[model samples]
Target chain A: MSHTLHREGRRRDLRGEFIVMSMAAKGINDAGAGPKLRRFLRIARKHGAVSVSDVKSVMHAVFTDIGAVESVLRDLRRARLGLSVTVTGLVAPIHRACCRSEVAEEPHTVAHSLGVWGNRRRLPSETVLSVMTMCGHSLVSVPLVEQAVASVRAGVCSPRAAAVKLAEPCVCGIFNVDRAARLIARLARSGKRR
Target chain B: MVQISKSKCVCCHRCALFCPVAAIRSGRDGASWIDEAICVECGVCVRNGCLSGAIRRRRSPWPRSVRALFSDPVTKHRSTGVPGRGTAESKTNDVTNRIQPGQVGLNVELGRPGVGTSFHQVQQVTRRMAKAGAGFEEQNPLTHLMSDRRRGVFPRELWPERVLSVVVEASLPLEELAGVLKELRAVERKIGTVFSVSVYCRWADRRRMLALVDRRRLLPQAKVNVGLGRARRQR
Candidate 1:
């Protein structure tokens, strides 16, 4: 009876954590929230299987959003529940639901955000995710771009500043210098350059 | 000969940083010196560093081969002109056959005779040989591996093993000499896995002796100095 009660308490804790994470993920996916949600979720999926500390480290690096952190915490809880359920030998019903709903929804949400971001930019959707994963913010965030450009103009930034501003981690990572230069030149030509 | 005054040496380490071959080394006195054998006489050190006016080229007589090429009758005739009013043919032949000391003039089969083999062709042949043997017979890898092994067996070889030598005047200050040496060593280290270096200051600066090696046999004959005319006079 004591064991049963302990298990029940753990389950409740996990459910609470999952609820918090799910709500945060949903909030990030909301229209106009930017790509922070998908970014966090992708990070969670990539690193969530590791220790909670590892997941948190990845989160701290990649996501500045509070909601994203909450989502990660919840995902951890859900992972614990999934592990616990699997251990308890209650396999059939849980397996069906896990395969149908949990597995499908997570990637779907990530794909949706990628599709949205792709519509506006020529960058590969995966590249956007990678940038968000490493930088902790959306690629199109104005503040980040401005800061990066400012650093470059001041001669303090490395050679990859403009690409980095566009969400590339480094200069080599964005092998699209011509395209970027063209964009900048076009902007400058049209009086729209920053 | 080039001279480095004692007061001008700063030890900022720029010369050491840019030497294409790591033939330079910093001495305990905080001055730089050149290892002659390792320095390629590239003049990169003299050009890049030496903010103190410490490094200068020495003067020496021109080599006979070079002088002979320039002193040919055809060259003298071209330069002297024909009895105040030279014929156009003589002028044209003089112009066509003229061989400047440093400039590599193109060979004209019908013009004046050519001298030593063209350096451009030599370099091209060397490049082709390098490329042809780059995959299997390249010496760099063997040299590197041997040097690594030798370091465990011999410690003294570390400083003198992998250098290109250059010549400087005997009057060059110890500090300037050290600077040049240090610069060359740094450059060598950057280019390859430099295992050892040794510098021989010849005639007090007229020339530098360098003993350098990677991992294989010791290369002890590299030398650097100011070219012929420059090595003879101390400047």
Candidate 2:
């Protein structure tokens, strides 16, 4: 899920983005991963995670709220399931949240994207990139984002509904619909102003 | 791996808009067809679900099947036993310590932001990174494609294959990062598709590494392993 690391947006625009992924070493710890992950999902939902991707070896829960991330981290730390939990988001806030959770350690490491490079001249606007990058696999295409914006500008569908449509192709299940809705609404408003 | 069923296609041409690479087009018969040459097999058209049931996914033979393995998240690469274009790089580093201090893990992601890429484009990068003295990560899915790791060469037969994205994972000493970025920039114009550069490093060494990279070039946000895991890497 390293691709999830490069989501585009301003600091405020990305405030609602936080993805927590849990995985166990394939043969060694994966024996009872199912039940441990079920409990992880339960705790995530309880803390207001917006979406959850439940699979056999790897699972992810996305949250739009930092408080939820902090709470989940604190709870998971207490649970001590021995599973590796990784969080993808802004470094400072994640560091601050980890500090608050009293993990007693700074972030172990971080992956920072140098943003998009090479032949980016014809790429979509930053707004579109912000929304499309949510699906790290690029399943959310530029045309789809434009279609969503057009639908919202034409009043053919609600922003939330259009956001849901845009989110359909992302199989990673990491696409944050709530944040996409907000960004889609913002994109529509900008298009209208233009 | 996915194709538009000629008989079922209504030629509404709507599905063409959903294709990231613009691979779908209307032929002389006024029916939508996918250009196999350009289709990255991302399955967007099929996943969108054509009301006419026009788009369908079928497994391809070996080597040709590699397209879906790299592009489709639902299709797992048997070698890595992981879905998506690459491994769980620095995301799980808190416990794994895959990237140790004084070292930087660089992921050169080709064919992103809706512009798909072929393996040949990926080789252009791997070759340059290799020349810069970077070591390729053994477990990365992209490395599995390399016919020669030292030369960053892929099998000649697979060079034409395209995918939504391919992540070239390599590592180098922290001090050499700036030079490697410069090397990538010099060759960036040669690669036909767009790609992004991501840097992974231990948190303690981030400050020094950040000093080597242009702050303006980096996205404001980042991905961090916040040390919430139970297992700690012992020095």
Candidate 3:
């Protein structure tokens, strides 16, 4: 249940959002995976992962920079812990990162979201949708995102601070605070221009 | 599944603003309460926490407890032992080989973060897919609740259960992609909530499946399983 997929935004904006999930399958390898998984989180944290979840089977982390993600991926490859690692983000950069790390094994599978299909009218504004969808499970509410944008626009809070507040709602710890700050800033600027 | 403690509540109404579905309501005096019928039991109001320590989660009964199972990420589904709404296979397609070269896995995800869905709405999409000759995945939690897999019907008692979102999983031969999309479009009008479609297939067929979907609606981001895990089944 990776919420990392189906994140909506422009390619340029999405370049700032990347999520990595490392899993030890229940039957195949979950036994005694605690230490290895902890190590995975450490590597992610060392490389400046904005958020990290230590959940055994569904461990994952989010990063805003391609360099950090590539470094973590490279470290995982070197570990050879035999865990299944999946990265979600823009296709080109992800492929480039995987290849650079020498983890781009052949016969890979690609899953694409055919965006929201029904009741488009019920969705929030495009900018709000972009930020909230980052949380995947929708823990980040529409009002909270709107409030953050307003706070930034009114100069009540900095984009970085608002982004941290926005990240508090996502329990999975996959929300990228850096990317969120950039998006919140964009929304605030757009609102001012309007 | 959660309520505002009147004794502890300072009438701040902070939780109301953070509710995804607007299930939390505030009075003119700033008193607040959760609308049980509207709550999906996602625990977002509580997870975000109440500043006054006013939020409390009450024990939910059988069918009602289903909400947390499907909506709460930490609550593991007893049916599948998987922690999220969908199965692990959906995310680890390459590792499991669950969706093979000759078949297409269709994920009809109903509901969004703000707009939750009832089980009855999910049945609408499942019935449509079943009629289109799609076979539901056996390990999928949604499929485990089906009272009649052949017709994709859920028990009458379960119709009212709500969740933040759910993925109705099913698969069919690669040749039936067009027919299934047509059926999905038909049901899309009747389904009250918004949902997204995800198609999973072998890496070799990515372009083939992409060619069939309307390019305008595809999101910019996509998930690629880089084959890091040892395949369970040999190709």
Candidate 4:
């Protein structure tokens, strides 16, 4: 009974799953991959596809994927979906990759990066720049981070609160609060001495 | 990277309230001003992110032009002339001829949805890859920031420049993946940013990649890109 109700609820929302995973079958002779394309589109439409991205030869959907829908896709056949299924590829969150290996090379220095800026601006201190650049949309600024830094040092706001406060402007929830707090703490300490 | 129509704006703070990064600040006149340094260009505040229809996209010039490409899904990259942020189909190693056999494509995507990374962070990874002699995807937008391709360094001038997110695509000998991973892990510790990675290799090397993922203690989650746009013809 709950499952049925849950599915009815699912129809409206993918159940808060924001991560969009898209699958594509690539390559074609001269006729076109239209049928397969339509099949993928049909499935995406059925699932309430959020954002459909067109890339010339590929159509990628940044839509929510979940369990009830997963089963349907699992049973999905190539012929039914429409395509010869020549090659398969994947796109995913870049963060999941964390592997350990020995490094024979040294890390790059900040000095070398400041290459010919004419009258252009130099990014703030590494710490400030790090915290400010967390949002992929470039919505965070150094002044705001600096203000947060000042507040944290003044006891006006805790580092956690400051980080949370800074993260408020971004709606994606991709802000790194833990890292922001650490940076805020560091920036606050630096501010205290200044 | 976001445009606000002053005339159309009702001074509604809904966009500000919903903005995850808090990049939107109101001026004394009640007009909302976006700090470019912090704005990652995500259209949340513009595309239905605002009920007032006051927010829109602001086209940037030259180096700053990259804002829309990486931030807006609809903006086409001026460099590659492609419609997406990362490299064309090449990022997938399909027909782009960018990545060849026995090679693994290591995409160090700097920045998440909320926590966008800067060219400064992207440079850290690119420089490391460049130092190791890894080939960057020529068509990738991030490569355009390389002040010196040889040194794997972004021009110092552009360092202060920030973006919501960027993908650093590089290809190296499959065997050298370990060293790159180690350097990346080290970077993870020093930099106060959050980023993820994507490793693309031949299907034959899937097991090896999974083993590396297991070794790193990471979850084996991946997004599949099924190219439905390519047209197929019968023989």
lDDT of 4 by residue, B106-190 (tens): 7665654235667777777777777677777676666665778776788776676665567677777777877877777667666
The whole-model C-alpha lDDT of candidate 3 against the native structure comes to 0.80
| Two-way lDDT contest, 1 vs 4, winner | 4
Off by over 4 Å in 2: A192-194, B77-84, B230-235
Better of 2 and 4 by lDDT: 2
Listed models, DockQ each: 0.01, 0.57, 0.60, 0.07
Q: Model 2, A123: alpha-carbon shift in Å? A: 1.0
lDDT of 2 by residue, A54-145 (tens): 64357788998888999999998888777777788877788888889986467787788898788877677888888998987888878788
Identify the runs in model 3 with alpha carbons over 4 angstroms from their true place: A105-107, A192-194, B77-84, B231-235
State how far residue A116 of model 2 sits from its true place (Å).
0.8
Cα lDDT listed for each candidate: 0.26, 0.81, 0.80, 0.51
Using DockQ as the yardstick, the better of models 1 and 4 is 4
DockQ of 1: 0.01
In model 3, what are the clashing residue pairs, if there are any? Answer: none
Question: How close is chain B to the truth by TM-score, in each candidate?
Answer: 0.28, 0.93, 0.92, 0.81
**lDDT per residue, candidate 2, B45-120, as tens digits?**
8877477888888988768788888887777656434444566677566666678889999988888867888888
Candidate 3 vs. true structure, TM-score? 0.93
Docking class of 4: incorrect
DockQ for candidate 3: 0.60
Clash count list over all predictions: 88, 0, 0, 59
